[model samples]
Target: MKNRLMITAITLLTAMLLLAGCGGQESSNVASDESGNKTEKDSGKPKVAVVLKGLDQEYFKLAEKGAKQAFKDLGVDGTFLAATTQTETEKLINILEDLINEDPDALVVMPSTEAAIPVLERYREKDIPVILIDTDLKWDGKTTYIGTDNYTAGQEAGKFLAEKLSKGDEIAILEGVLGTDVNEQRVKGVEDVMKEKGIKITASQAADFDRVKAVTVMENILTANPNIKGIFTANDEMAIGALKAVKARNLNIPIIGIDGTSDVLESISKGEVTASVAQEPYDMAYKGVENALKVLKGETVEKSIDSSIEVITKENAGEKLEEVKSILDK
Candidate 1:
């Protein structure tokens, strides 16, 4: 009886082992997701992770909308993530490293700066495609960059600002974070155009892309140069902040910024802000994921994708605001 029981136990062990061995890669079976969309999660779907700069601002939130929409539309198991703030480089790297271990098939990153290059290289080494959005890194392994031409946007802004001011009229520039390629290019574009138009640049100072910081910096600039005629901020937040500073002193001036956030658009509509060079943050992130999926599927993608830019002024600011609100609603 004991011998019979041992034989039965041995047979059951063999059966269990064979059953375990039969399980191979996950199936790509179609399944109904919670949203009633057909998904491949039941089996295995491509896992793509998107690590954006931060979600602290509306611009990044718009980018987030794009990524999420792209993930659903493309049928990929997308992981959308971001650091709490753009300045949290270390935290962003940590998140990237953890994502690397999970071995996502593709990565879409809107890096804060070049600080993310080494970590991105790891994805390259693993043969995982890395797509950059918003901020472009110098690494050759990047599948592509999808964002606005910051310099061109700046040039447009410069031209716009110059149109209202006479030659030799002094204007101050509120630069974004120093050492950033975005800030540098945008600032350079404005400087070049302003120089071409014979407009005097009184001060170009970094506000670290912080609205409150912009207020402080603008206060200092206004104090130092009380006759500052106009202001051009690298982004809308800084523009709004500078506006606050200008308003506090009852000074009315043309203040143009790059990002066309709804707040900026509203301000423009109300004739509070002069204008904003609108960038498609949502489209940048949307294309970033779409192209990453293409790279995963052994398809060729362009090394660069310009989402497009627009100058939102008082005339169209109200219309643009409605359009923007409709997109975020989706």
Candidate 2:
């Protein structure tokens, strides 16, 4: 009878140990799923998906550099995607949909248009965190926004141009794509400041933020108002185009543009572009990824983060160029 009781106790102990081992394994599997699949805390590094507007532009290239740097620093897996053309909203939306299917731990996006907002909303519905970089959309579902305050940057550009031009001086405006928040706010800021300064806007036309389109638009404006004294372009790409148009006319005009791209800085150094409202594209992208990681880790993060902006002119273009070079080089 004693031997039989001892054997029964040993059998019960073995059964309990087996059950506990199974329970532990199940709990680990649940934990891994709760965190995004393939997360650093579970399997390997967390995967982040970044969808930019277009990769062909200089500004986006700088942003890409920043995103890559963040991946290296944070030890996260990153996949970057972009539309071939800046204005291809359909393509961008499709890319976003495919990324959603992949179900990455986080997403960073620069929406090309308001049309992309609904697609982003779907991500929110699925409980995936998103961070907006560079351009912004009308939606509030994003985890956070990481970019310069474009309206404020536009106001700065206006103030810079206002200082150089006299009241009632005829100036032309080379606008970006229609219906983009960045373009609209920047234009409004410029209009408000120009109105206050009594500066007359000779012409304002949408160039879709394309350099080639800007050249044609600038030529048309010059033809209509050959006496225009100044020009304000929504971005540096358009500014460069306008500069080319002005050069072709053998005219000297103070042209201010946003985005302190290397090409624009070179133009500033050469006294071609008067100044630019320099945006921290690299910082915006880097912080976008960093903030996404924080979201994944359940850490608190600010809803909005301004990467900061600056005014780059001939006086300080060289210094700004070096700073930009350092970011791109890294």
TM-score of each: 0.87, 0.86
lDDT of 2 by residue, 140-249 (tens): 89898899888998899999999999998988999998988989999999999999999999899999889999999999999999889999999999999999999999
Stretches of candidate 2 off by over 4 Å are 1-43
RMSD of each: 5.9, 10.5
lDDT of 1 by residue, 1-330 (tens): 999999999999999988876653333233334254655543477777888878988999899888888877887787777999887888999989988877788999999888888988998999999998998777898989999888899999999999999988999999988888899999999999988989999998999888999999999999999878999999999999999999999999999999899989999999999999999998998898889888888999999899999999999998889978987783
Query: C-alpha displacement of 115 in model 2, angstroms?
Result: 0.4
> Which ten contiguous residues of candidate 1 have the minimum total lDDT?
25-34
What is the Cα-based lDDT of residue 200 in candidate 2?
95
Q: Which model scores highest in TM-score?
A: 1
Clashing residue pairs in candidate 1, if any?
27-43
